[model samples]
Target: MILKTILSGKHYQFKSVKDVMAKANEEKSGDTLAGIAAHNMQERVAAKVVLSQLTLNDVYEHPAVDYDHDEVTRMIIDDLDPLVFRQIKGWTFEQLREWLLATTTTNDIIHYLSQGLTSEMIAGVCKLMTNLDLITAAKKIINEKTANTTIGRPGTFSSRLQPNHPTDNLRGIMASTMEGLSMGIGDAVIGLNPVNDTVSGVTAILNTFNEFVTRWQVPTQTCVLAHVTTQMQAIEDGAPAGLIFQSIAGSQKANTAFGIDQHLIAQANQLGKQALQNKGQNVMYFETGQGSELSSDANFGADQVTMEARCYGFARHFDPFIVNTVVGFIGPEYLYDAKQVTRAGLEDHFMGKLSGLAMGCDVCYTNHMKADQNDIENLALLLANAGCTYIMGVPQADDVMLNYQSTGFQETATIRELLNLHPIPEFETWMEKIGISQNGRLTSKAGDASIFMEKESM
Candidate 1:
């Protein structure tokens, strides 16, 4: 494959496919910190020029991590439909990009083409897309998965209500949960990032969530973002978990740092299926982020975009109920500022949708980063327009436990109204019954958490 190109009378030479992938990416602090990003704009364009001409087969042959050495690479390659791959193997990245944007490419067509794509090819095409290109192409694809209720249906927007407290206080957590549900959020899930990751602590929280959801007849799933083993143990001890949750990485070594592997994830899925029988078919929820592999020293010298795309490729093997990137939570070291964070959020969402997963974004930032609530809100709106399946809904967009800012419950409610979107059909019906919403808009009673308390008294 050609890794050399000329741009505006300047010559640029990339050392490898990996090098081309890194340099071609739009500006990211992680890439620069990794010492792989282009030194100047001219070289960045030059890298893109060279990458645009590379064939799908060229990328396929040079997996970011060798198949022999990495299970993620193997899973990405082995799961591809051989028949579909043959038809598109010879197409150049430029050709693939144009075809995706062509009027002839319908959602069904793009979905079919996705069966043949490897993560490397997906990442390669992603680097060549402009910001609007990312939005336009992603908007055409709808990937839906069901755990307790369905998500990603057309005209639907959803939120994962995150009732996280600095301490795992059940009353405080429930207060937040009631408020979030009253605002017409939590249709996607009511998951928590536990302050305590122990089996007992996780089980207690899951049991409380299960009881509340059951009593209120909330049509959503509940999970505690504990380690996979802790969750498994909790489930084994009879905790009612609708979906098993884990944080995945793009490389085997990074996954190891997260204390997971394909075998472990597969085992968790099996346990989750048996536990959640008759509830839903898709039983796994995965979280990923750009720069995670780099953070763990496991990127194999690949760019964060390529590494992040590999995460989707790995995640698809399990047919996860939801897969979202915790964009910006990794802090300024990887994303730097609002512009970089916004770009990564868009790229990750687009790449995840193209990989055929129910995708969401955390739409968040750190206090130290050069960003504010406005930047997170802007990215949230963009992703919503791009057909994102769900986003996190923390109270006032602040997670005291996780120590970051994300999309708030009120923000989600407003976005649903502004975009003319509704929650999952069943959950929306439940909201109507409770007088929290009517005709897809929040009612006067929507903001009152005491509604549930009144019901409890009755």
Candidate 2:
């Protein structure tokens, strides 16, 4: 509906609601690669004009993927609150954006509003928002969830201490973990991207992290990022897991490509809830990224932004402890450069928060992307200001195992100081007790991994 707009004596037309959504999206290489992007900037603006006038009912009527054919679409549609949808179905996208930014609209209001929204509605409103609008609105919402420790509390920034070793060496992994913990990182999680995805290998790493955590009384979670099935098996075998990790996409087909389905993920959710020792109300950790659907041939003619928004829609169903978008890890073919990557990072964080999920970001880039560490660092700072739940803390901003650059332990510590933010309250207490940090600032003992060695030889 309302897919035609005339701007500057030029006629622009979109074939469908999905077409309008794709063209209205900001410039991203991924949408272009999918052959769905606007041909020119003028057309892009015209598409936004058309999108602004479209009603919520119009978008809701046209799910990006057919409801019957796709379980993701079905879930998004079926789960919508009929009462809330009726209250706002007549509202235009422009109105939605304005209401979201209105001073009278509080965080609780948006959380209530989210129940009625489908992924298309979220992506449509996002297209009409500026970067500052995303930041301003997202800052109003803080979705805190607990998994042993709470995240997303205002004035507290968190990081996942990713001590990944290429060979899954327990010694090297623990060394990186100790260094990160020493600098007051790992409050969010001390997670690893294991080179070995085997159940036994993952279990061993989980045990190692448990031992270290138990020894030091770290008030954080430990996760081993592996396949959901692998993690489920490990959990079933009594492995020490704080959070169950999985990479999810926006579409059923893409998730199938990842060897996952809603049923399987639901099973893992149930398993983690029952098996893990510190299983909090939220026991799942999900990672998503733009272009993943396209890469797997599962976008179904929707734009990457819409697909990415759908990811949050799916993740929220599980009450995840944290759901992060690996923004730039897909490479230049998708995000292209720092600007696009930054935009995507902000958008994903905003969308996740709007969906009522505790959102984090792996503010990261690969070597081939037209981005560097500085660009990622800037994005991380912006995200932190947006009240992002957490970010990854790899060693020196480089992931030797994942082959990407992310925020480092130093960056997490520095951001906390710059923003006058502290880690989780329980974690900060532990940090102070061990002399790694003092009164929200890093102590002289910070950054020394050998401090952990004072107890026993590893």
Per-residue C-alpha lDDT of model 1 across residues 1-458, encoded as one tens digit per residue: 88998777877889999999999999999999999999989899999999999999999999999999999999999999999999999999999999988877999989999999999999999999998899989999988888888889999999999999899999999999999988988999899999889999999999999888888888899999999999999999898888899999999999999998999999999998888743568999999999999998999899999999999999999999999999999998899999999899999999999999999999999899999999999999999898999999999899999899999988888888899988999999999988888877889998899899865622
lDDT of each: 0.92, 0.91
Best by lDDT: 1
Error of 2 at 249 (Å): 0.6
Pairs of colliding residues, candidate 2: none
Q: Write the per-residue lDDT of candidate 2 for residues 73-130, one digit (tens) a residue.
A: 8889988999999999999999999999999999888989989999889999999999
- The TM-score between candidate 1 and the true structure equals 0.99
Clashes per model (N, Cα, C within 3 A): 0, 0
RMSD of each: 1.0, 1.3
